[model samples]
Target: MPRSRSWLPLLALLLLPLLSAIATAADDTRPNILFLFTDDQAPWALNASGYDQAHTPVLDSLVKEGVYLTNAFTVTPVCSPSRASLMTSQYGSELGITDWLHPQREPEAGLKPGTLTWAKVLQDAGYRTGLVGKWHLGLTDAMHPTKFGYDYFMGFRGGGNSPKNPTLEKNGETKKFEGLTPDILTNHALEFLNVDSDKPFCLSVHYRAPHAAWLPVADEDWAPFKDLDPMIPNPDYPKLNVDRVKKMTREYLASVASVDRNVGRILNLLKEKNLDDNTIVIFSSDHGYNMGHNGIWHKGNGHWVLTENPPFTKNIPKGQRPNMYDNSIRVPTMIRWPGVVQAGSTIDKTVSNLDWFPTLLEMAGAELPADAKIHGNSFVPLLKGDDAKWDNDFYAEYSTKHQSHTHMRMIRTSEWKLIRDFLNEGRDELYHLTEDPAEANNLIASNSPEVQSVIKQLDAKILANMQAINDPVLKEAKAKSSN
Candidate 1:
């Protein structure tokens, strides 16, 4: 062979590895993200979370095959605000969404355009993003999910919807889907996943089940709980309606099972598509629910589930029990990262919905804008089981303007929790969480020096957190106190 020809073969040998690496790099799409979110799902709603009565086989399996976050919570325990915090990594107050948005009441209210969501970051980084199911943040066209980084959105922009044969928006058209709502939502989600694309994708499947009107579930979904007697959290509480609680429990678990079934379908599809290995599956809820827990039955703006509710107080209507209960804040959260997170692992560190924004950005290897401001730290290290510094202290706020009028701010540590209702006098509460995880004992008025000391410390921290965020409630509270 000529010298040139001989060198060509050697050169080809040297370039082969480089060419192969390039091909691999091109084919290595970033991990697809499947965020399955539920509405009004309590942290203990799943059997995997040790609630034996609940049938959530799919989610239980995910917990076994992934990292179960035992202390995952949302900053705000309402629909709109919690979701806003998840999208922006900022508190609901910071985003002007302190409560669930009412389409008629706040017709102009919606997520502000230009908000930097992790989805937008991922989308900018070449990932296809879609949101299916609920988008309660805003109702206007300007507040559409697509405006907040979703490439495609097929769900209601409002807070509530029927459980079956519901009307949902798809491809800019509001059409009625005939079937169980969860099944219908999952059907569209599967369609989103079936799209032929090489780009990585992020799909948020937000279910409105397990919320209210929790009925008319599929026969299979309802079969397990229909006739079964379920346990109530606290049947001995004053005026507690045991029968009502059990009935709601059965219905709620059935609704949750519907979500579980749909989740199974999604998982199966991911495996069938060979995307499971490369996809990150996260299951969580907008916020936790309370079904007769502490005699309350709702989310942040909870309602008294008593046979006879307390009389109407100033600003608080009859039956309304606005609160910052753990049952309303803590959520059932698990993430299955095929290779990164170890199977059957658990993280007890406190993480909030706010953290997801930065965690996902980091997960996608996407960068935030220089001017973006977020209030959450990335828990990616925790996900990887790395020994990293993690603060277990959590701060949360809820300013209910619709069902009730109150400014409830909370500071919770591993050992203690304090909730101060700034707007409602004598409504403050303090709990030694280490001793009373149920928050049954109200220690705010305790005479003990230790209890008082904790109250002072936690109250100060809550104020500091509010000040850090320039919470409007602080100014309002100050004015009210002076007046």
Candidate 2:
């Protein structure tokens, strides 16, 4: 996770009891967390069924059993930085992890070998941790999960998975399978569970499905959907059915279906172990994709001002990319903590991937360090139906591919969203979700003063969020640069 958030003495001293009671040696308190994170999945694409054509049967069922947050977001919309944020509970700005698939292809990311990960905190406080699939943080062995508190480590270390070159490592031993992706990963996770029968563990089951280079699921599983959209698309952006695009989306769903089956398998294993009642299941994705939404193919790429070939993805200038719009940042958050959280409940409160850290900490009853600085706050209380006023806004930032001054930052609430960019005239984009739910109109600089007033409110929200997670280091650097 990148190093953003806040550092201060924990105000709630009473949380110690809660921590100890909930966390076992390796399984922290508040039910074992099974965080199922996928890549490039849109909230709208998840089991919308007739509304949208995506097969996520297992995820669909899981959402029905518990709470589904419609407005969940990621701090950064890309790969490495987003997961880093989840692991550390800090935004990339805080962690200094500004890019995905970091240029250095190490094992655990650039994170220090012995640095205490949020997982380490849980493991230290009494929880067994296991992470499976796509650890794209840094590539160094020192960044490996086993040393960082996870008892098990089996997955790859890149933005996308390669079935042919699938790298599965157990402890320090590694195996590269020239086979399928989900099969290899699911087997690795299953192998870990099969070996350790009794330890209460938190497994972060990451599926690189619905991502690029989409492939079909195992036979008999996705065979049902094979006919749904047999063709797949290439990596080209914005086209729904160009070349392999349709096939790719189909393959994406097939991959998702396979991942779902794995989820089912894992759940069955838990139930077999009588751990279902004591577990929490969360399903989400890092960011979203543009499947022909206004001719946008992928994310972070925008249409040019005049050359209208469609903007989701294009051969654009290196530094210029799309703004930090909600479509690319918003994701589905389906959580099930049976008996503790409401059944079939839908919470519209704005949440971010950063919240996962502190939420897990609070749930497990672990002690946060006095000097620990985290940007995210715990939403566990809200999940439990406690009427609390959580923040209405979540923040998102996106930097250009070339690391130029082309950057965008946004603050989004339920009914409104504001994107301010130094690149686009600090071009402020304002959206009134009440009318334009899809965020089509820019209310900023509109004719109506009332519409323009929302821009002011949004501007204020962005500044407040910035201050909430402001790092003195970065602020000093910015000030220095300006001077």
Candidate 3:
């Protein structure tokens, strides 16, 4: 009996080791996800996007090695709503986050409790998830990144942070990090990658660089732009402040250069850890930026960068030029999936920030919860370069409650764009996008029957989108139109 019992124990020990090995093997098959995001990055701000003045070598390399999405855009061009859409695949208006969360004015505003994010989905599906940098969604305990399914979070919970010596939250405590902000964030990202485990991980590195206050970068980043006068997107607009635009352009490009430098660090780390092949790297911005584009300097809620300004209207302030310009909504986006996606591939299909949720879930082999309500489709097939039927039409919305006032909704196609300002009368705009890529011409006043017919069809599409979301402004907009 004792001899037989000893053999049984030996067999049990051998089986335990084998089972553990099998489990680890299964986990290793799942790819690690590294999502690198930036703040206020314009699509043309990259060298890869043909802006030769922009020094984004690392990013350009990523584009060469992966898939560059030429027409990527965000649902809302502001920080909070775009982040919300990226996280949950829901529009900003639906989540009641139509504007950037102002820390002082809107203390209680945030992503509601129990909101299911893609991070949570991946966490629930056995992947260790983390978000590093810029969670502008909420500033309270209930809306913390951990609450949104991030196993670890290290960044500011507000709209802005200093580019140098930023006070960031880390490991349940706020710590002031020394050095340029981009470098500091990347250092921490490297630490996260150094983990010695077989568990699949999903990490988001959201850089606050290139947002604003774009200075104090490392000398290496600034050297290229130092004493270099950068070209303004529109230097000839009336009273355009060419000098001011040039100064800001130099500063902005320097800020973008800082981000590119840090990205190089992250990519090197991935290769060093031998995780390059097994990891999927994605790069994008919260939304596109505008530096003197259409004579505007900021995003969705744009500000006129002019020596003289437009007069104050019923809804718009004197300096504010609230708009739905393509540059404000379009973002720079790329994805590097080694084995799955072919190198140097380019996808011109229109995709929005909303698509990231379902796309990431599908990549992770995770399923969306039965009750999950999302407004985006998975773009996995597009990434794989499949000949899948795709839609180039999309809708965008922005309601600037703080800086300005307007319920702006847009319907954009390859040929035309229609923007309706529901709060203000006669502020509608229509552009033939193919002929007028700069959107310098507003044909909203045209009485041509052809133009009117196109507007009618596009207006119907916008209303349909609003109705589907049960947009809160729909009733008021309808009433105002009728009056």
The lDDT for every candidate, in the order shown, is 0.90, 0.69, 0.92
Cα misplacement distance, residue 461 of candidate 1 (Å)? 0.8
Error of 1 at 291 (Å): 1.4
Q: Which candidate is the best by TM-score?
A: 3
Q: State which candidate has the highest lDDT.
A: 3
lDDT tens digits by residue: candidate 2, 347-426: 88888888888888877777887777677888998899999988877777765554234456787777888877644353
The weakest ten consecutive residues by lDDT in model 1 span: 1-10
lDDT of 3 at 474: 98
lDDT string, candidate 3, 119-234, tens digits = 99999988988888999999999999999999989898998999999999999899888888999899888888887777899999999989999998999999999999787777
Worst 10 residues of 2 by lDDT: 304-313
Clashes of 2: 45
Output the better candidate (1/3) by lDDT: 3
